[model samples]
Target: MSLNGPRGSAWAMTERTARDVDRAKHHFSVGPSAMRWDGETLVIDIAEVSSPLPYKVRGTIRVRPEMIGSTAFSLDPEGRHRWHPVAPRAHVEVSMTDPGLRWSGAGYFDSNFGDEALEDGFNDWHWSRAHLRNDVAVLYEGKRRDGTPFDLALRLDRMGNWHDIEQPAPVRLPRSAWMIERLTRADRGFIPRVAKTWVDAPFYARSKLSTRLFGENVEAVHESLSLNRFRSTIVQGMLPFRMPRAIWR
Candidate 1:
């Protein structure tokens, strides 16, 4: 679990064995935290201690989907990886007891699954999602390990209809604080600017971009992931500090 905000930021990824995990049709639990779907909404209960700081991070997040998506797209030619936009549009409410904060806003939910490690299939990837006047736009592109490239431009309407649109021209953004490359897509002649950076790490970066997409101006949530960086020995050695392992209960 991770929370990045003005009040403070907390990240906790406790490694738990299979014995400490439980799951059902609509509920899943690992260690002290759990997520459950209650017919209309998805509720997440988080109870964790931040790594390297030991700060309490207890909160409840509710995600109410405005429209549910039903299609999953393949990310690789061999069908080894897939991406699904479960909730293309949603309303999210955040209530944190540890920090005594509450807020609500537009949100999105998605899932990704693969048969092999991400590094074995890709070099890096850039993705962004934005809300248009009556639809949502998602852009995805990446370079494969074998030097192949793939891209997808999709738009979803309020009624959960999906449409494939022409991909806009690529726009380069400033590198992250860690020197990670950042990129996005925008209409011709328009440049995309980084409005805010939420998570900036050696292997990944998440930020907000102000750009024009498909004739609409929007503030999009953007992310870049470098599998090569994540596979480095230095980053692997530093993972324990950010993601501590917990003893089996």
Candidate 2:
């Protein structure tokens, strides 16, 4: 899914998959999305989407590693789940050909892998990424299923320095239309406000917001996920409407 509310545009598409999925190493292709590491960079390609909204959307974004290191941390105490920001602050070049979608600028890339489904390991979580002048800061805070809470604060600088920073205070933002509470960590006196509601659903939401962090006022990508709500029958029933998928050849 992608959104540009400032330009009055948004899109979402999903492709169904079989029960058994290929577990290839560092490479996979399914439906409209595919990725493979080419030694120097991670290449991602997306084909034209035709669901949720009919539009020809496609692009290839390469995430090249920089001198600054990445972040790899475990989410659970048992090490069942882990997250990695391979290229926290990478130069993104976009060549997407679409009617109302074309952009090329700085972007972020990350991945998550776990031993079990998220619903079985987590209840809710708030994630935010702030791109600064010479560094990129990210925050991860959430509650584990076993009632354990974890908060991580990390910053990667351009000179290959990775350090742990103090956790900024939680800046509360207004709830979404779905009544999902939104909050993010920011520096002192750094007010954060949602600039756009890219995607808001019963159990998930993604937004772009502004905040002061790393001594700069930066726009951050924020997301909130509620595994408890996602496991509900009502949300599952409504999922087809937003993520309807057909067999892909």
Candidate 3:
């Protein structure tokens, strides 16, 4: 989930990336499927997969009744997860309801956060979320590439657990399928990508480092992630040779 507008409001833009596409159709996408109480706090499960990347990512975010203490999240698929107070509030900037999770507002660390800070945050941000429903309203507003205000919202759908498994295509793999693609939309447009998370991602480590580290030790935890550069790629505007991989899985 991503932050959209001011606090109490949110906007979410779910996308398909090159990683998910296949002969069936490039398809990597993310969405909230189910949310329920694991007692007092809310537990949300999320899955993601990228073709170019070897790992398929999936995990859950747990929220406590207090909305602060015991509120944590973990990504088991990528051999990564952070449970401590990553954000300043010692919790995430989230509020959930019936339809989906809205990343409308961030943490108190960002209460005073503006554009530059927000931009940096996005680049470095892993994820953020807010809960919402029909009774509850959420509005996400931001600047588009043209610098125009970009906004979206999740009013009321039917929050919690999607109708079925949040898979890209109907096809299945050993654990799950993973794919990636590079496309040109037009003469002058951004390339399209497809990735599937929650559906499948590979985990190579035998030891669950994050779970053990977070559940036990700490250096200095984080509440919300400060964006730096989420992802970067080098393309050939002009080049004689191309980089190639020697093997394929």
Q: Estimate each model's TM-score.
A: 0.96, 0.85, 0.23
Residue lDDT tens for model 2, 1-249: 464545445465675575423446888776657788877877877675645566666767677766435456899988889998877877766555553455667777878998999999998899998877878888889888888888888888886567899999888888889988787988788788898888888998889897888678889999988888998999887777766655433
- C-alpha local distance difference test of each model: 0.91, 0.77, 0.26
For model 1, the run of ten residues with the poorest summed lDDT: 240-249
**Shift in Å, residue 98, candidate 2:** 4.4
Name the TM-score of candidate 1: 0.96
Q: Give the Å error, residue 175, model 3.
A: 38
What is the Å distance of residue 198 in model 3 from its true position? 21
**What does candidate 3's lDDT look like per residue over 96-193, in tens digits?**
44123444222222123222324422322211222322111122222222233322222222221112111111111122232221111111222212
Candidate 2 C-alpha error for residue 97, in Å: 3.0
- Per-prediction tally of clashes: 0, 0, 57
Give a tens-digit lDDT track for model 1, residues 174-242: 999999999899999998889899999999999989999989989999999999999999998888888
Candidate 2 lands at a TM-score of 0.85
